[model samples]
Target: MAVSHLPRTSGRLAIIAGAGALPHHVAEAARRQGEDPFIIALSREADADWSGFDHATLAIGDFAAISKAFAAEGIDRVVLSGAVRRRPDWRDIRPTLKTLAKVPSVLRTLVSGGDDAVLRMAMDLIEASGARVIGAHEVVPGLLADIGPIGEHTSTDDDLRDIEAGIAAANALGTLDVGQGAVAIGGRVVALEGAEGTDAMLARVAELKADGRVSSRRRGVLVKLCKPQQDERADLPSIGPSTVAGAEAAGLAGIAVEAGRALVLERPAVIETANRSGLFVLGIERNARERPR
Candidate 1:
């Protein structure tokens, strides 16, 4: 059944958990706030640590089942978090009369779009069934990166120029619904991240560095920013410890994210990793980036 109106707050939030520490963190953080979340773990994607929570397991493509679970548990709000690597396979979709109505758009969305468009389509599917979809940052406020540089290394003048270049490249890529990040070396783009994700993109850069394709003077910077026309509440670019490791392996000088917009998981570990690897991390302010530094 469709909801008449989306509730402002769920009496009990249903955390639609996926892979990674994020789902667990969101659950724990919400509990500390006295807002206990019910874990709806996606099969094979979520971890087994959700044992204590009021929870259920379902397939990513189990749209009808997911809705039924939420309705049965009296869940009002649903938060989509973690990495869902592959989009739902068309054959995996088990549609009811309600979801069958969504088939036309669903089919088109599943086969013919970039990450953001596909994500928006999936969120719309959840909302169509009377559940509200919110970003993970809403549940775990501390996940957003802070402004300025973080870790042991600081940005030098050359690094700052590379950072600025990376930001412009990232923004341009995002406008085309391409990806969230780009690697800039000495004031020019060396690589752009794609559906393979940031890590894969960094790996590509590493390959380039090994092949002597990249500059010998200075390593590049990885700039991750929110898409210019993105729905911030639904999807935002994220980075974590793994990101730092990838950048390090890529021979990157530093990493930068949009302050208060992008999510950073395992922040302490991220900082530690970056510092140990001699790679700097920064949370850049958009407005400040616009004017000459």
Candidate 2:
């Protein structure tokens, strides 16, 4: 497995954790690289157990506390990882002087925009606190999806049609900043991910299949790609073992994600699960524009 390298920066790194294992993976990778990361685990949003690490639990909108922690810890580089379940309520925010002026804009985006806009607002606030924001893949390069199959199975010719359809649908869905994933069966799009996310979308596919709304004889493919104007530093499309299980339950024949532009959490486990379930897990080229004939 070839891994990309990110330029190493001096000073302490902070993991602004949300919900999922990605933050923990980054922290472990940092430790292997001989750095002790200060974890800022978001309360309620972060479900991981942080007992072994030096960490602070704070609310998502507690900018005042986050800024103070950044200053005290001398954090120079920060990685925002995992999922935030909901937008912060106005009453929950405790903004510092530096972020006070931007609170209204943040709230506006949170109310009226997509996840990408909200993340940009959060990143702006993080930078205002004097810390540079970096992608989780920068901290753990091996997490990036490589070009080609990472599992035992490869996509069949029939699967290629679904993959192409999925890629097109995903890009169209992304253009609206709605979501990054889509499911296609028999060269027809069956679902487009929304705020409910990939898992929920897959669950819906399963329901549709059970209700005989979608073709059960011809299994589909789930494709996750980076949004058309996505910030690669945060929220690159991600997949894991759970993704494999979801695809399996949804009767998918394979899964595809944008190579180098997507994150594959627990690659070995993801591949193993996909292989066990006889599903192809492929990493297509990032700028895959040519449709399969």
Candidate 3:
């Protein structure tokens, strides 16, 4: 997969704005690649004036309005970035009639698990709209995290055992779309992320560790990975400085993520924080053999 060979938008344009810093980074990368990346700020989500890009505007769920904005600016490619809170709470996702028709099938796909169903539907809609959906990394090639453990400490034998255990549990749990992260201590499941999210799971792990009931030999280990059928183009698992903080608060010994399958936000800061806190932040490849017990 040639990740960096994005079709040249030499005289072309793009909408490089969304919910997270990834969109902002994508915009900058696009400009560096010689395309004038227009910015689209979601209501209360993105920074319109970020890095003084081409143009910016706030859209609140009006897909027609978004299309109009792109067409008016002659944007040929749309680079979606950041994470939009999913439906029900998706205040900014005003789907057109065409998109609405997809709602039922999309919901079914979501229910079936993984991100593919929704992303494929979205891609179809985007293509139907005459705009191409390109990977955000197409503009920013360096965002991909290198394979292997990426922190101050490598996984100890016990840590590896716990990690293996966490992987098994995470993968199995992911199949149910329950959560993508798990915390294990001494090869025993301490916590699993659910509707409460990773931070809450960390807190739960801390509470368990402090309870003096379980015989966990150490603090905890955090493992975050996407479901086997997750969409690579959308909703990829992400980690950043906040993740490190959460792990620290939970007394976790390390954090592991799927290499090349997850996003590392604020990489330098995340690594520095993990190093300072003595937390091991490693990237592991997801394979059937790596599942935890």
Maximum-TM-score candidate: 2
lDDT of 1 at 146: 77
Q: Model-by-model lDDT, in order?
A: 0.80, 0.88, 0.70
List where candidate 1 sits over 4 angstroms from the true fold: 1-10, 47-49, 99-104, 287-293
Q: How far out, in Å, is residue 222 in model 2?
A: 0.2
Better of 2 and 3 by lDDT: 2
Q: How many backbone clashes does candidate 3 have?
A: 6
C-alpha TM-score for every candidate: 0.87, 0.94, 0.81
Q: What's the CA RMSD for each of the models?
A: 4.3, 2.3, 3.9
lDDT (Cα, tens digit) per residue for candidate 1, span 188-263? 8999988788889999999888888886567889999988788765567888899999998888888989887888
Worst 10 residues of 2 by lDDT: 284-293
Q: Which candidate is the best by lDDT?
A: 2
Task: Score residue 63 of candidate 3 by CA lDDT.
Answer: 66
Best-to-worst TM-score order:
2, 1, 3
What CA RMSD would candidate 2 show? 2.3
User: Candidate 3 — which residues are off by over 4 angstroms?
Assistant: 10-20, 29-35, 44-51, 54-60, 86-94, 97-116, 211-217, 288-293
Cα lDDT tens digits for candidate 3, 60-149:
456667667767787777776775444322444566776667554644454453445556666666666667777666666756655676
After superposition of all CA atoms, the RMSD between model 1 and the true structure is 4.3
Deviation in Å, model 1, residue 130 alpha carbon: 2.0
